[model samples]
Target: MDQTEKNVQTLFSMGFLDIEDIKNALRISHNDLSEAVAILTNDQVRYGPYSSAGPAEDVEMKDVTSTALVPTAAPPPYNSLPDAKPCSPKPDYGNTAFPQTNLYELEQRVFVDQWSIPYKKDESLAKCLIAATSLAKEGNHP
Candidate 1:
């Protein structure tokens, strides 16, 4: 296996699937958090933000029967069943960036004038602001 795969295996074997461990093992920045998480999916170790990655890599897949092979033919259509309606496309809400009303300009100005002046470690605030912007873009509130 390649270096990345081996590293993932070693980390998984050592139970280093938590966000901090994954970040350190993968050398992933906060900005690339989603991408880092995607790697876990390849190893069948899906994990939510608040949930730990499930199971371990060394486990084997269970032997299963072929349900498809034993399947019977489809039954005749019943007259009592209602006709399936065509699904209509959802309405497109035009591109609307949020807090929607340029309120972030004030925050931007404050950031520029205060914290950003001396280049302080404002990553937390920056992430929050960026998240707010993303939420607005998705038509969701902060």
Candidate 2:
């Protein structure tokens, strides 16, 4: 709408008064800012107090300090529990899906877009692979 209509919303957003009351005030005061403000200010109790600028109803505060939060799941029984064992089938951290066979591809994947690499040691791994491959290709042992 127009600037006045926009300003009406802005006034309503100031955590005081309702749109209808603001509109009525603007209408009654012939669009005078000070007079409209005075109108809303004078008759606060008559409006039954608009809910803190938002469209939501007034929320009552409840005492939560004494109450312990309910747990999501019941604790497992101690008597029925199995003896704790070391984690079986440990993850193969060496195995990866990244370029490993080709040195050029590995170098490009490592150096070009290094940030996009998933693992922190991707560059180190790629560098090792490239070095091994270069040594192998050149018939040099190191």
Candidate 3:
């Protein structure tokens, strides 16, 4: 039902006195389970008359049922590859002009492959080179 009823039921199930005793404790302790427990324990009324007999038999039955469902076999071992090696850490290339140089080299290679442009024609390649350089500087690529 309500919170106080739940607290009374919990206290009753925890082997902590009878339903009447738990209710009285809950009432005296403002429905706080911890305070009610403390009150019951202080009065030397921790366990109910039927608590010892009922719970012990129930616990034994639960243990029997749980053990029956458990598997007795040992688990298999894990296999790992012999040739697997951890990768080396990458080198930090701090703010340098290496990327711009690499971009120029890649653009030259692409121009040579796609347009069949001879290496001697500087004037004709200048326009395409300028556009490629601008795009590479702006962190954009075709």
Residue ranges of candidate 3 with Cα displaced over 4 Å: 43-142
Off by over 4 Å in 2: 43-142
What lDDT is obtained when candidate 3 is compared to the true structure?
A: 0.51
- TM-score on alpha carbons, each prediction: 0.17, 0.28, 0.30
State candidate 1's TM-score. Answer: 0.17
lDDT values of the candidates?
0.41, 0.51, 0.51
Per-residue C-alpha lDDT of model 3 across residues 29-138, encoded as one tens digit per residue:
67888877876775335434433223423211113454555554532211122322232243223332334443444355455423222232222234345545666787
Candidate 1 all-Cα RMSD: 19.8
Reference-based lDDT, residue 58, model 3: 23
Candidates in order: C-alpha RMSD to true structure? 19.8, 19.5, 24.8
For candidate 2, write residues 25-105 as lDDT tens digits: 676656767666766776444333462323442323347699997655543332232432222243224433323433443
Better of 2 and 3 by TM-score: 3
Give the clash total for candidate 2: 0
